[model samples]
Target: MTQPNLPLLKWAALFEGSSLLALIFIAMPLKYMAAISTVVKIIGPIHGFLFLSFVAIILFYLLTRKLPATTTLIGLVSAFIPFGSFVFKAKYLQ
Candidate 1:
């Protein structure tokens, strides 16, 4: 991969990781500890942006690299689930 593409991939991974942490640790706890819906109120927008970026990066990578159709599909679909990016990183991204 080129240097330019590398940053996008890395950012996508970071966004995904942060969102996962927010969902699991911050959001989940907020719901029970304070009765505040932090996930939907605060973390939602952040995760939404991350998910969008992940999709954009996937499209950009697909166009630039010779990625398999299955990989592309997996990357696209994985953005919907919490911690999906981590799974993608473990299973697909090297």
Candidate 2:
């Protein structure tokens, strides 16, 4: 597979980060505080899909771009942390 272009990476990162934020700041709160399961049910799958897509791109670039092991590791790890993908994009992907 080819390395994803910077624009593609940026777009994916933006979407993945946004989904993570919504899942955490919107869905989680609604699920916990308001006893609302619907938002979580909706946002959770969306975030999961976005996150997986972001990670797949990361891995693809890791091979095609020959990224350092640390950078690859960071990309994967960031997917699990809220706002991490945004920070990663700014700090490393740029």
Candidate 3:
């Protein structure tokens, strides 16, 4: 059986990436700098879930779609940086 490619790949990719950015840039900063842990308490779990989902999607694309190594690498790497997913989509996910 073949799994269909993720139809909303770009949207999911952007969302996952954005969530991570929000956690790192917005939530973490708010938690540490302002003595407010509420943001991390809320956003941390959400970001973790999104990150896992994103990686799962990337793995699906890699195993099922047989994406090129370079493309797969970009997709995997993009999850680490704040704006990397957008760049990855613009360059490779097209």
lDDT of each: 0.74, 0.84, 0.76
- Tell me each candidate's TM-score: 0.72, 0.80, 0.76
Give lDDT tens digits, candidate 1, residues 1-94: 2223355666687787788688778887888888888565778778778888888888878887755667888878878766778877766776
Clashing residue pairs for model 3: none
lDDT of 3 by residue, 1-94 (tens): 2223445667778888788789989998998899999999999899888877887878777887667666777778887777787787676666
- Give the candidates in order of lDDT, highest first: 2, 3, 1
lDDT of 2 by residue, 1-94 (tens): 2332467677888999998889889999999999999999999999889989999888887787656678889888988877999988888777
Span of ten consecutive residues with least summed lDDT in model 2: 1-10
CA RMSD of each candidate after superposition: 3.4, 3.8, 4.5
What is the C-alpha local distance difference test score of candidate 1? Answer: 0.74
For model 1, the superposed segments whose C-alpha errors exceed 4 Å read 1-5, 38-40
In terms of lDDT, the best-performing candidate is: 2
Error of 2 at 5 (Å): 5.3
